[model samples]
Target: MNERDVPGWKNCDTMSGTTAGTTAVGTSGTQALDTREPGAGFGEMTRRWRDLTGESVPLPAFSAGTRAGLRGRFQATRLSDTLVVDFAADSAFRTAGTPVAGEDVVRLWIVRRGQWALGNSRTDNETTVSAGGFMLRHVGRLTHFATPPRTVAQVFVLPRTLMRERTVTGPAGTAELRLLVAHARMVRRTLSGLGPAGVEAARGTLLELARAVAGRRFDDQEPLLASPLAQAAKDLAAARLSDPDLSAAGLARELRVSLRTLQRAFSAQGESVTGHLREQRLEAARAALLTAAPGWSIADVAAHWQFADASHFSRAFRARYALTPTEYLRQQRELRAR
Candidate 1:
């Protein structure tokens, strides 16, 4: 397809469509591609977009530093098999003329770099999202959103059947909204650091974020970590790692338990209760040293994780990993560069 063949092709809009309905919107300012026509700009752009997003829409306009000064509705013609995404950046776009609601698509809004507000009159619920926040609305649900000028958002329209296969769960009978500041930051960092190798990572991150917002706990929320007894023991041990007087006896007394009972729990994991505490503190110290960025001395990282002293931390780190912390970090960065 050639650029001229694109129905509403314009220099200010950049889109790539695959098959029929699958379209991807690019942030770069360029012309839409017409897959049905013979051309380079549009065809190449659309192909790349199709590769990025599994589902697509028709062509979409990419914002070119334009600002929406007042209340207005933005519309685009797009369709997809399982998902449709209407996206805009640097513009405040809203729905118009009471969109014909249907339960065919589950809608999600991701604030890429700005703030947004969305609500459903039918459900009497509203949500506001800043950068990294997401809002979900069920298919065929009547919804409204208002954003300040220069807001940027990507609207994802996914089918209910697609989400069902994933067994997503959340607040019953209400849309799930999540603030993912940390997750988003991590994803962006991974993307920046790894380049093309980060594509799979990005997909996994998106799915995990979706599941989390849907009220699903991934491995990060292990049941063991959430157990009251386990948490209390962990806290107590963490607080007294530096004191030689700190032992299972002290921990048991602090937790209102006998030493034997505490031992039983630790035994279940094949770990000595006091030994596990020491191991954790040492591991934390090692991690701090390995991850300390340039300009941070190895001694500083060891101190931050509360090592007994630099010499103690160095011996422990070498024994555990067969290398000093500084050497380990140097190797890690070299490996990443490759």
Candidate 2:
């Protein structure tokens, strides 16, 4: 309860009424107690979490089964520059609390064992996470989660500054409410790979996973460029661009729109759906070539961008950039050297 009582975990002088816990066993930093109960004593926790992560949201009840009797523990620790938190409960409970807005908390959770469901009021996104899957919480709006029976999860609470410094974009703001279901077996394997000495490695791997999920959502907004049907069709096409067999019929089937409707959607943009796909593919290919290493072969770069053949890739590259892939790479190197 008090700072002097808990050894290794001290009190942050700058943060009043908060306890700091540090471990010499691993990376060194501070751990602070912000809130214990789901609704009670959460002000400090909300303030500190928001300060570090820039996410604001209302803390919902731990569960709905108990009618708000069970209280969740809120503990935060700073490992080097990264922050970690743990929220646990052995019983089922729920609550209808006010929303916490404008705060972002990028959370990496390992549901050690048990089932949990997290719902976001703002995004209307509900995620049911099982024992093996990992959950990343992006805190910005009203969010809620509950577990059945004995549930334990280790949450890595990351600061916005640390994420930005690492060039890692996680589900922050409204984006955090989205649920990412990673491969359960792969997640278990990754966790197994993290022994006592592999904490840093584990942290990096988890961060990559979190960033990928968040980045995909961020990139997915391109489909909402126009409106109702047109944007939906465009989004579907973008999501399936890697599938070489993706066709206008397949896209129409996925979007549940008639071929005529799909055609009209693209016509509004003054281009056909097939034309858009070609343009996107060409743009992607150009980007891949531009970023390829100086010594990377033209064929390798072409393959990376999913070009059908080297000659076709060369023709498209020349048509678009007025230079072949080889010529472009050579010019880039010359510019860099100069």
Candidate 3:
């Protein structure tokens, strides 16, 4: 399919052909397809996705009409000889195919956003995964999937030989799955900066976590070793610091960890969840103060960063940086002038 047939992607480049082979060798690292670029379209995205991951999407479900801003990001990271992590989001598509010979891999598709309808052509049975749910299948056989628009998902591709069972699926409520997702995120986020040894270590940690999720093995301490839940919390908090309701309990709930577990994770790193969150907010506010528009006020910056009020913001800012917001702003301006 070409760009003309796909709305919202009219500016993207067009190309043709289907059928991709997942012939990654000698540490292929990562392959990516981002349709958000200028002059980029699903035609090229599909071809690239097919070529990299050996999955084919000949027809995306846009016939009935789709949202105009149809953009997407896909990445397949080969973490080890036995493990590959595939992530895709903000796209509507369908994938149906039997593997080429020797394509012996098991795939676990975890849905983070919209629903996924997965079917087995042979059995004619289907499984639907809602947000926070997961479906696992052995890709050595026929499997099909339909993803809804604006879907966010991740697929953990493992060699079939690694799994003791043929299928591994789980509900949205599983703590194990949540922890696995956390670990996967940690590994993916840190992979680029890691040395060869660090990457291998992360790969092994994630693979073990995946095995535990598949019910192959388990150790109570395995999850903790696999993920820096505190770091993940910090990353998430930094992004959502503007929300006044964001707190340790909310963060723990979102991360699928107990309040105690969240506290322990932070304590292990010599910090408290609320304290770290506050520090991050203050830092963000400080940066904003430096570049804020002339009309922006101290109270505006304080409110934007979720401080209770300008007075509370000033007290906290003074305690942390030894200067009130007003003083810090003036000091920065004076420094710039000098």
Candidate 4:
């Protein structure tokens, strides 16, 4: 089976050196790969699958019908810095568990129809995601997945750099996980109608929700008893901290709440909105300083995290951690060198 075998192929391959026949779905970096055709063999399907998803599915040693029985589609949409893939299938398949080069993505698989059998190669642990449940996996690691027939799911592919943890595993039905699933479904359902700004906001919301579920915390400073609206506002702020224009009023507008209402939500927790945002930015800048790459500087961290200037960032850093940004970076380097 080749490109000619599948109808309506749109050539959605965005990566370099992509073959010319496959097609995409949306205008803004959305790619959809289909293999629902009865005549489309597994070899072609698996090749396109690997191309689009960075995962490889080889023919099983014992199965002769694997080629003819496989049929599914992977629809991936790029949202700002992240990716969300919705998949549906009518057959069972297992991945080779090989790592893809230069792919630094963490996946949150939300199972809406069937179950997923996941194996962590490092720990030799097996986890299952049943219907209405989800599992988180870092694509950089070697992890095996066995998806049975009739499985329908959505995969939220978040950048590893955007996450604080490499991988975290836990039971399903966590409140954060539930919110993430609902939020993702809502974004995808209303995706087309959302213009540029709306798309950006949606991206931030989804990323925030995914991070909450994966990192196992919404905001470290957010009081456990904080109101739901306050927690949500924190999530949004954390997501858009890189924006220099982010403010309490902007947050209130995005959250569809009055400014006073939003302030009261934070006030009830004994915190002010502006103060909380500053704390979040300072913490984020500190994290960046600690993880500073080669050629990275304090000024870069300051500007990226939306500080007015290096001096202001230094003052804030000293106030929070009792050490200037340069001192903190040097201390972290010394510790790593040891």
Candidate 3's TM-score reads 0.64
* Residue-wise C-alpha lDDT for candidate 1, range 166-215, written one tens digit per residue: 32323221211222223333333333234332433333444444554556
Tens-place lDDT digits, model 3, residues 1-338? 23333333222222211112422221222333334455555566555544444442222323222223344554455554544445444557555333243456677878878887766542343777888878766656435566776777777777666564467776744655655666666655555456556656666766666676777334544445424566667666877989888999997887666788788878777889889988999999999988888899999999999998999999999999999988987888899899
Better of 1 and 4 by TM-score: 4
**C-alpha local distance difference test of each model:** 0.48, 0.50, 0.63, 0.64
Which sections of candidate 4 miss by over 4 Å?
Answer: 1-39, 42-68, 73-75, 120-125, 141-143, 164-166, 170-172, 215-338
The TM-score-based order of candidates, best leading, equals 3, 4, 2, 1
lDDT of 4 by residue, 226-312 (tens): 355576677678779999789999977765557887788789889999999999999888888767688988899899998888999
**Best prediction by lDDT:** 4
Question: In candidate 3, residue 58 scores what lDDT?
Answer: 25
TM-score of 1: 0.37
Runs with alpha carbons beyond 4 Å of true place in candidate 3: 1-72, 82-92, 122-125, 148-150, 166-174, 215-220, 223-226, 235-261, 267-270, 287-312, 319-322, 331-338
Per-prediction TM-score to the true structure, in the order listed? 0.37, 0.39, 0.64, 0.47
C-alpha RMSD values across all candidates: 12.8, 17.3, 7.4, 19.7
Per-residue alpha-carbon lDDT of candidate 2 for residues 1-338, written as tens digits (9 for 90 to 100): 33333222223322221222522112222234423343434455445455432232234543233543343443443323344545555444343434545546565566656765666642343666677556555544436655675576655655453233222222222221121222112222243233443444334433543554545432223232122345445555666666677777776665545677667757767878877777777787777777768787678767765678889889988998899888987898899999
Question: Which residues of candidate 1, in runs, are more than 4 Å off?
Answer: 1-103, 110-113, 118-134, 141-156, 161-298, 325-338
The positional error of residue 110 in candidate 1, measured at the CA in angstroms, is: 4.8
Clash list (residue pairs), candidate 3? 12-40
